[model samples]
Target: MPNSNPAHTSKYEESGVSQTGAETALGHLLKHVLPTRQFNTQFPVKADIGYFANVIDLGNGQGVALCTDGVGTKMRVAELLNQYDTIGIDCVAMNVNDLICIGARPISMVDYIACSHIEAHVFDQLGQGLAEGARQAGISISGGEISQIGEIITGIDLIGAALGHIHLDRINTGQHIQPGNLILGLAASGVHSNGLTLARRVLLGETPEMQQERVHQYESALDRTLGAELLEPTRIYVQPVLEMFEAGIDLKALVHITGGGLLNLLRVQTQNIRFVIDPVPDVPPVFSLIQQRGDITDAEMYEVFNMGVGFCIVVEHANDAEAVQKICKQHSISCHGIGYVETTDAGHNEVVVPSKNLIGSGSRFSAA
Candidate 1:
């Protein structure tokens, strides 16, 4: 969290999600599940535990990264609007963005759609979004599954797995993210695929006043129903971040700002350093709209939403910061020089944003 926006008394109480319980379950799962995946004698497991993507050796000094993620409660927004096209893009973005965090170039993806029953137009619309997302990421839609489990579930849940390859020498596991490294922030499209449980709880009331509020369009950054803004697809960083690599900008760390907002920065670093982020990017109108409706504090907003910076990069050399800015401009990505890595004065692996009164030393999210 960037600032201590007085923890919402109901942050965990009324919100329908339990990040802490999920992490505890994951910890238990890792203990039993990880011990069984033995290293490949030929393509040995190079990186699996404690990182963004799991890397198993692919022989001849090459490795493969595989990551899978699903469109979470954002799908509820799609359902609320009776729109089904763009949620597939959220599925791809959630998966491929995590794949790139380990410096792998995404090559292909496979989608999974589970619904009570598939409507013909809904299927076609979902496929349209998937195809467009694949084009944006420069990856193939290799294969997928669509199942109608009548009693097993409700509406369609879109999920996907992305695969990428990298030379072992090119892997960036944040092992070298040392003190004094520059942190570069990338702009988000809008609340990219997380925290919808709280959003829906606060925004989806059935009262006449709530209905009026949902349809009320804003004058600032957004011009649609609050529900429409919630349905915006997650942004995919594969192409531009790949361009950064092709441009020879050696990034030491990459953080995908999903779920836990600024605290996602901890995922790309060792436990010995602290991140001091100054002056977060301006919150997009959609997010501000949610804050106003929910009566959410700045700290809580940063805790749940991306707060505009969708992705982050760390570079050891200060001079590389300008090169990064120039290249990102060529791609038209809004890049901000937000913060830097430095030795921890209090604890290990913490992110402190004084302006926001947030200290992200520990994240409530777990990508494991």
Candidate 2:
């Protein structure tokens, strides 16, 4: 368990971004109106408005899943350190991870890079990381666009959109998730590309010491420079999840713990099921250091960053969890049995963090 909360401040809110505000802003945007048919096929599009990725049915038990995501504020850390290699991996991981949440096997990806000016060597280095990521994810970089939008952008912004295939019958829609399902957690590779905005504000905020310091000057509890620790690329979980799928294991739901932190778990859940997460396991040392340095409350930390758990798997039974853990270990990623699912009030979707008064509502955190 983590240390008890004392007086703590919210880093994300102070940084001029609000989770609630982002959600509200999205509400007014034009709804995605899908045409009834494309090419006169009998199969229609599966309206995947809330899940991790949108599934487009192509009939005959075949479907395509597509998702797009960026590396978020993690780019700032990379810029500060002058390292551009692993950020590309973060970009691919963000998209492929989301695609697999709906049981899609990522087939290929295309990247979009926008910047005022990018060095030739920098692009080459980024390509190296992207290739490595595609290999790890078993995908290909088919095509992309790189635009030099002078003056309009000051920093490099990289985004990737990935497409995958899945059998609709094999999709883990969470509609079948019921009481007594085991919740399995896959350990993160450090913070894994989210919440760097709050982290940067906490560590390098307007201090003379920071101005004089280099990324290597700060040593992390994980026995690495803070820059290297923060630069650790996001882990790719596609292989293991797909392996389980191949082995005939039924994945009830997949949560690629990202921007909303543990709250990402709620995207698949409905009002009838309450996901009761256990008190987090011994958090990674990197996260502990962040919490202490930022004076961030446990609830806020869990809400903003992954707090050490990168991916979550909801299985039909405890035996299924053990099997999944075994598969994760074989793939060389750390794994843990984190929590379970249970019955809840109708249309009352909630994720209860055991032993804490923190529960995730639809759009924000609320007192349990």
Candidate 3:
């Protein structure tokens, strides 16, 4: 028989931490940790696909790039709300947003949808959302696949892959991220499609009617239910970022803050560098309500939610920072100089939280 007391479990004996605490720490590690890649390995296939985009050297200054990602467990909230339309847009935005992070111009996209059963209405709404997303990203949906796997899929799963083009020398892979660089933040379009699993588990515990009532209290103009707010399509950054690159700005690195929240920025830099963010904007009301209702820790809230800023660019000191702001304004997108890069000790990459109680507790990136 299994031990009823969790303290007797092997996990507790080995780690000396409580079972509940160990479980939480393990979950956090799995979500936040990134594995290191070795450079001395011989390979039959040679391609680096770690950054926002992967570029292949085909000689002659021409190259093909690709980026792929999914909307993640945000689909679960959409399922609970019976809203599947806008998720397709989230799928596209997640990939294209990353593509632009490496200065790639998104040219085409392909979607993969797996479902438990075939429902024409579901596909219709999903298709409309996907088409609209592709249009917004300035990319064509050449083709995609829909798998009806009843036994494997409990709800619909939407994922996408994007193909793009970039010049050989134009990729922003953080190779030029020097000390004293400026970090520019691009505002998110509400939630922007991440951390929904935790959000739903913690925030949306009420029934559909209860959720409607709660959401209406926050936003008087919101006629749709709470699920609708959760399903807001992710903002596509392809056009604006690409425009910045074409304008001859010396961009050093770009970070797309997705599944891992602000921590995603650490993926682009390795040396002892810190981001000093000042005047962190007020989080969305929905997020505020979630934090208040759940009484969630401030660290957990920033770790799991975008909390306003979504995408960021590390620009060289010599770059035209004003051009970035002007272009973003011309496109009607909000842009701000949120922070600056600072040198640190070896093997330390940190994000300085502006708030003392919340994420401002000095969170360090775990070993990748």
How do all models score by TM-score?
Answer: 0.91, 0.92, 0.81
Best-to-worst ranking by lDDT = 2, 1, 3
Tens-place lDDT per residue, model 3, 46-164, is 23444666765556776667778888767866666566778888989998998887767889999999889888888898898899899888999999998989899787888899988
Write down the TM-score for model 2: 0.92
Q: Rate the local accuracy (lDDT) of all candidates.
A: 0.79, 0.81, 0.70
C-alpha RMSD for every candidate: 3.5, 2.8, 7.3
The TM-score between candidate 3 and the true structure equals 0.81
Q: Residue 5 of candidate 3: its Cα lDDT?
A: 32
User: Regarding TM-score, does 1 or 2 come out ahead?
Assistant: 2
- The sequence of per-residue lDDT tens digits that candidate 2 reaches over residues 62-156 is 99998898888778777777788888899999999999998899999999998889798889978988999999999999999999997788778
- Candidate closest to the true structure, highest lDDT: 2
Error of 2 at 8 (Å): 7.7
**Which 10-residue span in candidate 1 carries the lowest summed lDDT?**
1-10
Candidate 1 differs from the real structure by a C-alpha RMSD in angstroms, to one decimal, of: 3.5
